[model samples]
Target chain A: MSTFRADLHIHSCLSPCGELSASPRAIARSARERGLHLIALTDHNSARNAPAFAAACRSEGLAAVFGIEITTREEVHALTLFPTVKTALEAGDEAYERLESEPFDPGFFGDQVWVDENEEIEGMLDKLCILCATDLSLDDLGPWCRSRGGILIPAHIDRPAFGVLGQLGFLPEGPFEAVECTEPLSEDLTDPWPVIASSDAHRPEDIGCRCLEFEAPEADFEALVMALESGKTRALYGNK
Target chain B: MTIKELQTDMNCRAVWNGWEDREVTGAYTSDLLSDVMARSEEGQVLITIQAHKNTVAVAVLKDLSGIITASNRPVPDDMIETARDEEIPVFVTDNNQYETGWRLHELGGF
Candidate 1:
C-alpha cells in the first residue's frame, strides 16, 4: 500500500458560494498541479457536478470521491461522501427534498453554474444551493447517508459558524465515521472518531492547502473508506 | 433596565424565565455566535435570530444577561431546556433585530 494525498472537502462552481473559476476542469487541474492524487467534489447541498467532476478527474488521472457538503436543519455542515456519482446524486436529491424552495439570485448569493468537463457552462441550478435542509436534522443525516453506502463526517467542527459543535452547542451522539477540522485538532474536541483536515476549498487556488495522507492500495473510494476505518490516516496541514 | 422590565416594556413573550430578573447594562445583536462571544460584554442581552442551544451556550460563556430571539424565530424545546438548566432566561420578540435594538436604545438603560 502507498500513501496518497487527498483533499476531500472541495467545492465546485455548483456551490452558490463557490467562485465561478472553480469549474470541474479547473478544480481537477489545480489538484493535480498541487500534487494531490485523490480529491473530492463536495458542493453545497447538491452533487449535480459529480458526473462532470468524474470526467475531469479521469482526464487529469486523479482518483475522485463524489459527495456534498450538506447543511442540515440545525445549520450544521457535514461532508457526506458516496462510493459513486450515482449515489452522490441520490444523496443530493434527499437533501434537496428537505430544503425550502427559494429562488436562486445570482447578484446576491453568487452564481450556481453547472460546468462540464470541457469547461463549458451547461446551465444553472434553479434554487439556492446554500439553503439549509429545513427538514433534515443532524441526527437523521448519519442513518440516511449510511443506508445508501455513504459516510458522514462533521465538517470543520472547530469553526464557530455552520459547524455541528457550534450550532448544536455540542456534538450529539451519532454514527460519525470521522470529523474534519481546518485547524489543528484541539484537545477539547478529542473524540473516539479520527480527526481529519481539509482545505474546504471554494476556489481552485485553495485546493490542497490542507489535506490528509492515508495509506491505501489505490486512491479509490473503497480504499479510502478502509483506510479511515483501520486508522491509517494522518491529518496534514499547511499549504503544499 | 432589567430582563423582566425589557420583556414587559417590549411586549416580548417570556419563553423560559428560569433565572431571576437581572439588570441588562447593554445589548448585542448578531446571528454569528463567535462575533457575539467576542464582542459582547457581561450583563448584555443578546438579540439574535439564532434560536438554538449553542446560542444559550454562548450566553452562558459570556455571562450575558439573557437571550432575546428576534424576528419571531422559533426556539426549539431543547434550547429552552438548556437555558432553563443554565439559569438563563430566554425571551421572544415579534420585532426584528433592528427594531428590537432601537427600542432598547430608546429605553436609555441599555
Candidate 2:
C-alpha cells in the first residue's frame, strides 16, 4: 500500500481573493518541492483554471484533481470534485448560471481573472460575482451536481459563516461524501458523516500545510474518491 | 405609498423601472447585506447607499418595495440589470438617507 500525501482543497488565481502568485505553474512546482503526492485545484464557484492547472501538474509528474468551491444560495459553501477536467468545467458553467444575479466588477470587489499555465490572462469571468454565494441551495446542489457525476463535501464546517452546520444548524445528509474542517476536530462536534481537514489554501505556502493522508493501491482520482466514500482513510490532520 | 408615487414626488430617476405599482408600507436602510437580509421586511423600501450587485440579491431575498441609490450615487451597471431581471424597481435620488427617512415618516406607517 502506498501512503498518499494529499492536499485536496486549493485555490488558483481565478479566485478573486487568491494570491496572484498562486498560478498553475507556481502551484505545481511548489507542490513538487513540498513533496505533495496529490494536489487538487479548487477555485471558488468556477473551475475554468483546471486545464492549465492539470497541464502544469502533468509536467511536474504530480497527481492533480479538478474541483470547485461553490457557495450555495443560502450562503453555505461546499467543495465538489470531478474526476475529469472536462466534466468539472462543464459543471462549473452550470453553477455560474445559478450565481447571484450581480456580475463581477473588478473596480468594486477586485478581479475574477482566468489564467493559463504560464499565468497569462485568458479573459475575465464577468457574469459571476465570485465573492458572494451563488444562487443555489443545498437541496438544489446535490441533485444537479450528482447527475453530472461530482462529489459534494460541505467545506470548513468549523467556521460560522458559510459552513453547512454553522449556517443551516444541521447537515442535510445529502449525497455528500464527507465534510471538511479547517480547524482542529472537537469531540464536542458531532455529525453522521465523516470529517476531513484541508488547508483550503489560497497561497502557495499554505498548500499541503494541512492535508489528508491515506493508503491506496494508486493515488489517482478514482482511488481517492473511493477511499473517502468507503471511509477507508479518515484523515491525517498534520500541522505543517 | 406606492413606489411610483414616492419616485414621482422625490424626482428620482429610474435606472430600471420595475413593478412601480409595488406598495411601500415600510422602509429599511443599511450598508451591510446581512443586516438588510436579517432585519428588512417585505414591501419595505430599502434606502442604502450600497451600490453593489449583492444589494439586488438582498432586495430580492427580503422582498423589498424598491431600491433608491441615495445622494445620486452610481449603482453598479449589473445591479440595475438584476433589479430589472427580478422585476424590482430601482431608482436614484439626490436625497440622502436622512432626507429619505424623513420623507417616509411624513408618508407614515413606514
Candidate 3:
C-alpha cells in the first residue's frame, strides 16, 4: 500500500485559541500548497466552522474531517473525528448544551465569527467557547463521542496540561485504538496505542507541519477511519 | 478612519509591522479573550493590556481591524508573529488604561 500525509488536528478561526487568518479558505489553501493530503478542522469544543471548512477543502481537493478538540470536565482533551459533518454538528450541539453556563462578554474576549463557504461573515456566537468544558468526566467523554459515531483520539497525550497521561494519571481503557500527540513517537507511554502526530496548529500556516504518513487505500473519511482504527503501529510514520 | 489615522490621532506606535489600511469602524476595550469573542464586532479596534500570544487569536476570531496594547504592556514577539501571520495590525501606547480609553472615546466622537 501507499502512505498519504494527514494532519487530522487543525483549528479554524472559530477557535479563540486560533488566529483569525485561520479562516477555512485560508487553511485549505495553505494545506493544499503544503502538499497535505487531508486535514481536520477540529475547533476547540465547537464544530461551528466545520461546514464552511469542509466546503473550502472541497474546492482545494483536500479531504477535511469534521471534528472537535473537546475538553472534558476533568480538563482532559480528546479529538473527536466524525464520519460526516452532520454528525459532528449534532454531537457539537449536545456538547455545547452540556458546557457549564458561562456567559460571554464581547467587551473582553472578542467576537466569534462564523464564516460561510464564500468566506462571508455569516453570524457570530456569544458563548466563550474555549472556557466551557463538557459535563462528561474522562471516562464518559470517550463513550459519549463514540456513541455519536466519532473516533476519539486523546489529544496531545504527552503534554503536562490537558493530556490524558498528565490529567488522568493514565490513559483510560476505552474504544480508542489510536492516539494523537503533538510530537512524534513519544516513548514514555505506559501503553502504546498506535500513535498519530499532528501539528495541533492554531495558525493557518502551521497546518500539516507535524502530520502522519499512513497507509490508506483512499484519502476520504472512511479510508481514514479504517486506517486509524486498524492502528498498524509499524505502518505509521510521524514527522515530529 | 484607517488604522494609520487611528494611530496618528491617538499618538501610538506600530509595535509590529502589522499595519494594514483596514478601517476602524469602532473600538472595543477588554482584558479577557472570551469577552472579546462574545461581544466585540468585526472590524473594530481592540484595546487591552493583556499582551500575550492569545491576543492575536482574539483579533483573528473577531476580524478586528487592529489591536492596541494599552497601559504600555510589552507585546511579546510570538504574539506579534501571530498578528503578522494573520495580517492584523497591532499598535502600542505608553498611556495607562483610562487615558487610552479617554483618547479612543474622543476619537470615536461618541
Candidate 4:
C-alpha cells in the first residue's frame, strides 16, 4: 500500500462564497500541481459541479470524490462524500429541494454559477441561497448519507464557527464515518473517531493546503473509505 | 432590571429560566458570536438570532447575563439544556435584533 494524499473538502465556483476563478478544471489542475492524488468537489449544499470536477480530475489523472458541504438545520457544516457522481447528484437534489426559496441576491451572497467540465458556464441557481441551512439536521443526515452509500463527516470540528462542536456545543451520537479538523490532530480532541483534515478550500491556491495521508493500494474512493473506516488516516498540516 | 423583568418588558418567552435572577446592566445585539465574545461586557444581555447551543457557550464565556434569541428564531432543546446547565436564561422575542435592542435601550438596559 502507498500513502496517498487526499483533500476531501474543496468548494467549486458553484459555492457562492468561492472565488469565480475556482472552476472545476482550474481546481483539478491545481490539485495535480500540488501532488494531490485524491480530491473531492464539496461545494456548499450542492454537488452540481461534481460532474465537471470528476471529468477534470480524470483528465488530470487524479481520483475525485463527489461531495457536498451540507449546512444542516442547526447550522452545522457536515461533509458528505459519495462513491459515484450519480449518487452525489442525487444527494445534491435532496439538499437543493430542502433549501428555503429565498430570493438570492448575487451582489450580496455572491454568484452560484454552475460550470461544465470544459470550464464553460452552464447555468446559475438564482432562486435559492446555497449558503443557508437545509431542513436536514445532523441527526437526519447521518443515516441519510450512509443509506445512500455515502459517508458524513462533521467539517472543521476545531473551528468555533459553523462547526459541529461549535453549533451543537458537543458532537451528538451519530453514525459519523470520520471527523474533519482543519488543524493537526491533538490530544485536546478526545473523540474516538478517525480524524482527517482538509483545506476546505474556496480558491484554487488553497486546494491542498491541508490534506489526508492514508495507506491505500490506490487513490480511489473505496480505498479512501476503507482507510477512514479503519482509522488509518493521518492529517497533514502545514508542509508536513 | 432582572432578566425576568426584561423578558416581561420585552415580551419575550423564556426558553430556559436560570437558577437565579440576574440584572441586565446592558445589551449588545449581534448574530456573530465572535463579535459578542470580543465586545459584549459582563451583566449584558446578548440580543441575537443565533439560537444554537454555541451561543449559550459564548454567553458563558463572556459572562453575559442572558441570551435573547431575536426574530423568534427557533431555540433547540439542546441550547435550552445548555443554558439551564450554565444558569444562563434563554429567551425568545418576536422582534428582530434592532427592535429588541431598541426596546432594551428604552428599558435602560444599556
Candidate 5:
C-alpha cells in the first residue's frame, strides 16, 4: 500500500496564529485520533518547541519532523524540515539571527506564549519570540537546511503573501527543492518544479485534513523528502 | 499615496498607534491559515476576510504589522478584544478582499 497518511506542515502555540490547543501533546493526540502517521510542528521561525513536541510524538508512536517556517529577506516563505530535532534547533538559531528584528508593537498583537506537551501554559517568551531572524536569504536558507539534513520547500506559491512568485515575481535561481500549494494545480504548469500540498494547520481540527500521499520505503522525513524531490507524490485531502 | 496618507484618506483607524511611522513595506493577502503562518514576514500587513481568532494567532506569529479584514466585514468582538490585548492592529474595509488588497497595494506602492 502507498504510504499516504502524513501532515508535513503544522504550527504549535509557539506560532502567533496557532490555536491554544496547538500544544505538542495536543497535536500528537489529535494526529493519533485522525490516524496520521507523521506530523511536523513547524512554528514560524522558532523551533523551540520541537524537542518537546518530538518527544511527545514518539511517546504516542507518531513520527514527528522538526521544522521551521522561515520568512526570507525577500519576504518569501519557505519550510525547512530537519531529520533530527538537533538539526532543527541549530537551524532555528541561524533563523533567529537571520530573521530577528526589533519587535513591532502593532498594539494589536499580544505576547506569544510557549506550551509543553501536557497542554500546560508556559511562561511568556521574551525578545519577541515571533521575530526569530532577519539575516537568512533564500540562497542561504537552502544550504543551511541541506547541511542539517533537512529539506526546504517554497511555501504556498499560489497565494499572494510570502510566496516566491508574489514576492520575487519568480522562483529564485536555486535552493528550493519543491513548491508547496494550498490548492491543486495541473502537473504541466511551467514552474519546472514538484508540488506538495499541506493544510499548514494551526488548529487541531486542521491536522491531516489535507496531506500528500507518496510511495516510499518507510514513513519518515527522509523518505518523504526523497519522494517529494523525485516528484513521486500526490496530494490527498481527507474527507472527514 | 503613502500608507500614512492612505490610512487617513481611507479613515483607517490605527489599532496599534505605534506602527504609524513604519513605512508600509508591502502587503500580503491570504485566507488559508497555514499558508499565512508559513509565509508572512515581521512587518508586513496581512489582508484577509477570515475573521476568526486564529487569524490573530497567525498574524502575531508572523509579527505582522497589522491585519485588515476586507469586504466591510465586521471584526468579531472577541477577536477585536483579543487584538486590543495583543497590540496588533486590526481593521475592517468596505472593499472586498481582492479589491482591498489591490487598493492597499496601489496605495502602498507595492
Candidate 6:
C-alpha cells in the first residue's frame, strides 16, 4: 500500500473526444477533491494545454506530469510524459506537425480555445498554424519524448483499438519506459514487463477514479516518474 | 544480434543499407498508428503488415530505424520509394505478423 496517489492519464479539452469542461483548472480541482497527490494531462497528440494544466495543479499544491497522448502510425496509442511543460510543449510541436495535415490554417479549428489557470478563455492559439500540419512518425515521436527527458508508455495495451497488443500483436521496443492498462489485468501480468493502470479519463469527474500509487522520495513530478519507471507502484480503483 | 544480423537471420534483404549503421534497440510489432506514434522509440525496428503512405509517415514520425512488412507481403512501390527518400529500411518477410513478431522476440532477446 503506497502513500502517494497518482492519476497519470487524464485528458484535457484538446482531445476531440474530451469534455469541454475538461479544463486544466477543472482537472486540478477534481484531482484535489479526489485526493490525488499527482496527475498528468495527456491530451491527444497535443501538449498545448500542459503548461496551463501544470500551473493549475501547482496552485493547488498538486504535482503534475506534462504529457500528451500521441497516436502512432501503427494506430497504437501511447502516453508521452515530460518532466516539464516546456519539454512537453517542444515535443508537442514536433507531434503537431506530424499528426496534422500540411499547409495548416488556424482559422480551420475555430472551435479550439486556450485558457489560463483560472479557466478563463484567454484567446485562440496564434500558432493554430502549427497545429495544421505534421509529418512525424510514431517511432520518431517516442525518441523526441525521450530526448526531452520524458517517458513514453503504451496506452491501454489490453484494449482492442489503438492498443499495442491489439494492433502490433506485441510490444515494440522503442522509447517506452512503461505500459499502461486501462482496465485490470485479466491475466497474471508479471515479470519481463512493468505495467500500470489509469482511468484514461476524458472528464474531470473521471479523475482519480482509477489511479496508480507510487512510493517516491517526494510528491514531485520527476520523483513520481522515476518511481513509475522503476516499477515501484500499484494500481488502485475507486468504484470497484 | 544487431538489426543487420536479425535481417540476415530472417533472410531479409536490406532495402535501405544505411539501417545497418543504426543500432537495434528492440523490436516492436504493431499496425495501430496512434499507439505506434505514442510508443515507438528511435533506432528501434518496427514490424507490421499494414502498408500505406501513412505507414511511412508514421515511421518517419517515430524515428524508427527500419520497418518490416510481415506476412510475406510485398511493400507498395510508393512506400518503397518513400522509404528510400526517408532513409528508412523497408522489407517484406515470408512470416506472418504473429510468427515474425515471435521470431524476432526469440532471436533479438527483446
Estimated TM-score for each candidate:
0.72, 0.69, 0.66, 0.72, 0.69, 0.62
Which has the greatest DockQ? 5
Enumerate the chain B TM-scores of all models.
0.96, 0.92, 0.92, 0.94, 0.82, 0.87
Which candidate model has the greater TM-score, 1 or 2? Answer: 1
Model 4, B1-110: lDDT tens digits are 98878978888899865458878888888765545655678899998887888788667756788998888888988888888887888888899889888888888636
CAPRI band of model 5? incorrect
Relative to the real complex, the DockQ score for model 1 comes to 0.05
Residues forming the 10-long window of minimal summed lDDT in candidate 3 chain A: A231-240
Those runs of model 5 whose alpha carbons end farther than 4 Å from true positions after fitting are A104-107, A121-123, A127-133, A186-190, A237-240, B1-110
Worst 10 residues of 1 chain B by lDDT: B31-40
Candidate lDDT scores, in order, read 0.84, 0.77, 0.77, 0.83, 0.73, 0.72
True contacts kept of each: 0.00, 0.00, 0.04, 0.00, 0.00, 0.15
Stretches of candidate 4 exceeding 4 Å from the true structure: A127-131, A185-190, B1-46, B49-110
TM-score of 2: 0.69
TM-score of chain B of 6: 0.87
Cα lDDT tens digits, model 3, A159-221, are 755677766677777657578776554455734567788888888878877887767877877
Q: Over the full model, what C-alpha lDDT does candidate 5 score relative to the true structure?
A: 0.73
Once model 4 is optimally superposed onto the true structure by TM-score, how far is the C-alpha of residue A43 displaced, in angstroms? 0.5
State the DockQ, from 0 to 1, for candidate 2: 0.05
Q: What class would a CAPRI assessor give candidate 3's docking?
A: incorrect
TM-score of chain B of 4: 0.94
* Residue A105 lDDT in candidate 3: 56
Candidate 5 lDDT by residue in tens digits, A1-240: 367577888888777667766788888888888877888878888788887798789988987889889977666678889888888878876676555455544333444566665656665444444423355788987887888788888888776656777667667767567778877765553267777777888888888877877778887887887787777887775535
- What are the per-residue Cα lDDT tens digits for candidate 3 across B7-85? 8899998877746587788888876455565578988888888677667866776678988998788888888887887
Candidate of highest lDDT:
1
